[model samples]
Target: MKIYKILNNNAVVVKEHDEEKIVMGSGIAFQKKKNDIINRQKVEKIFVMNEGNEKFQELLKTLPEEHIQIAEDIITYAEGYLQVPLSNHIHISLTDHLSFAIERHQQGFQINNKLLTEIKALYKKEFEIGKWAVQYVAEKLKVQLPVDEAGHIALHIHTAKLGSGDIASTLQQTTIISEMIEIIHQELGMDLDEESISYQRLLTHLRFALTRIESNEPFQVMDPDMLEIIQTKYAKAYTIAVKVADYLEKEYDIQLPSSEMGYISLHIQRLIT
Candidate 1:
């Protein structure tokens, strides 16, 4: 592909099939001008723009080559580990976060993540990946990143996985899920078996419930006979579900309709049994 624009000595914008793509490698654009044919052997990474190229071009201008390269490596590793395709925008977000994180660390300013505990509990796999990324960044940059930064990185990964790109909302959902799990533990007087199918089912149910709550969507009302039967059959679980609803109402100002309560009670019952 011929270079359409040069981002730097190591990076260039190329057009293929009438689409713009950012290509990068060591000295890929050295002494190259627009319309020059690119040497494919030197290219290490290619970023296909999903929204617009302007933001990426801006990022390339300000971020160092090492930071960008590290971000790309982390994203690639995360995709392989998670076995899911991350949103293309992760390249932009991760690079920007790393750049800021490095600057803050250099200037002796450390940022704390208030949701660190919740992030670790709710997003176990992603948080583990984030910790690995932190170590990777530290070794590569020769600067130690604070543990809290792992939580921040996990949030970015979670947001990308959700494809929502809303960090605040993703964090809220995590906090909610964590709180629910805590309630379950407290009410059941035992730790959950994380590897069990029941726990996975409950976790999935809670995730979707949080999504609906965030969207202000109420669950469909259940038939009175069925609701009564569920409430009576799973009395303890129903009570726990009520406690969860109370927590949601008090903490998030979200009301759990009776319809939602019935399904949540079922999931809780499955966990206990």
Candidate 2:
């Protein structure tokens, strides 16, 4: 492969079989110019540049080569740990996030991930990878990042695992769930134990509820008789569920089905009683 563009001393864009590819290695592009043939022996990794990836191309040009390498290494670890192929956009999104995170840390800034507890409770596997990544970065860059940063990284890993490349949606879902949990606490007037089975069940229900709404997948429709029975028997829980439904509709423009509310009310009743 011949060099089409040099991103840095260790990375370059090469042309192979009429396709652009990113090639990276130590000193791979040293003293090399455009059109120079890459030393095949020195090549370590070859990435087929995705078409219409202008953002990734620009990221390669501007981000420090070491940061990109760290991002790639962390991604490789995450994939191996999960035993799944992540979305290609994780290359762009994770690298961008990692870069910004490191820069902020160096400038003595801290970002608190408010969803840390929810993330750790919900995304255990991804959060484990995030903890490892924080230790890895601390060793590599000598920067001790806060555990909150691990939660942020876990969200990135989870977003990649989902193959959606939509971090905003993932964060929004986590945020909505957290808020809904708070609503339950305030409505029921109790400090719900996070480690309890009831709390876990509630989290699972809310997670699936959000997933159902987002995908527009229908759940088992409740009959009017059962719905009425639940509404009458668990009046407070049903009312809280209705408030949650209204909040979702008003804040996120997501209209939860009546059947879904019925299910949510059952879960809330279990939690409260």
Candidate 3:
């Protein structure tokens, strides 16, 4: 592996002779400008780097059609998800996931079922995201994940975690729920009962959960046993409000907003719990 360009001290760009692919790595620094000598110790991971430049074009030649296409899909999908435009930061996570998807496909790994019904229910938009990713991979690596295949993979990524890993650690219960509950209690004053306030907060939390679940973000319910009890106790409101998240997931395909999900889930908690 030869040093090509250093992104920063934490990252570097290099070319690998054996694989003949352009790669990027972390914990590396460039000694010179664009064209400079790179120290071997600085190299982290030697593979292809994404940039809409000559380097990207050169790197493409070394990749198979499938890989190239998958890479492209990863790029487009990432841009939308991250809300980041294409630049020197080709998004390490996105590229890594694409490579994983492509390799798994090549090696004949089965696609795991994660959010199948949810994604298929919101088929149009989800498929649009999937199509963009599939086309990008096809064009870049000349490989394509079937619509359903890509759908499963994409949903898997969204639902996973907050970080780069496959299992995303959803942020836990925040004081916000309790605080909001207090606020509502105070706002309702002597006119409303304490139980009513609790119910409101429970619904709120469920609404919040809806958003998180839809976005593949991590969310926490108040308590499981308590929630189930409420579901049995307050069957009517519980059933109606419970449908809020289901309706959104099935109808719009997009998750409810955080605030909305919180309110909804909170209400559900008050009822069943």
Candidate 4:
């Protein structure tokens, strides 16, 4: 790949096979000029132009080298753990978030995540990785970040896992799932085992349900016979599902069709048993 432009001593815009890529590493672009062939050995990370050149360039201009490196490390670890490729936008969003977080910590300003509990409850694995990230960032950046910041980082990973660029919607989904879980717990008069397979299944169900709700997809129609059987057999679970449906209707203005109720009640029955 040949250098198309140099962003800094450690970063450069390169072109390979007629496609633009932003490469970064320690001294990767030092003394390099446009049209110079890049030394692949110095490259630490390569960001494809999956989002857009303009947005990538803007990030390259303002994001510090350390911040970018930290984001890259986090993304690498998350991808391995998730067993899925994350969206390229995480490169930008995570870096920006880390940069701002570091700045806030330095300025003695701490922002609390109002959805911290919800995020932790809904995204357990990601939240654990986020906590690890907190320690990693602290050791590397020599600054202490609050536990709430871990929740924020978890949300970023959650957003990447969903492949959705809208952080707001991702957060809303988290909130919705957490609220539903709380409702189930309250109605059942018990604390849920977060590590239980049934709980995990419930979370997966809510995750996709929120996706459908957000995308305005119509729910599948259920057979009256099956719906009646489910409602009669798992009356308690079906009642809890109704509460969840009512919450969704009031909060997001999305109705849960009978099929949704059946699925939710089935998951609830599994959890209750």
Best by TM-score, which number? Answer: 2
Q: Compare candidates 1 and 3 on lDDT and give the better one.
A: 1
* 180-219: candidate 2 lDDT, tens digit per residue: 8888889899888888877888888899888877887888
Q: Report the Cα lDDT for residue 48, model 1.
A: 85
Clashes of each: 0, 0, 55, 0
lDDT value for candidate 2? 0.87
Rank candidates by lDDT, best first: 2, 1, 4, 3
- A best-first ranking of the candidates according to their TM-score comes to 2, 4, 1, 3
Q: Per-candidate TM vs. native?
A: 0.75, 0.89, 0.37, 0.79
* lDDT against the true structure, each candidate: 0.85, 0.87, 0.47, 0.85
Residues 64-156 of candidate 4: C-alpha lDDT, one tens digit per residue: 778777778888998988888887778778888888998889999977987786677677888988998899998998888999999999988
Clash list (residue pairs), candidate 2: none
Candidate 2 stretches greater than 4 Å from native: 162-165, 223-225
Name the best candidate (by lDDT).
Answer: 2
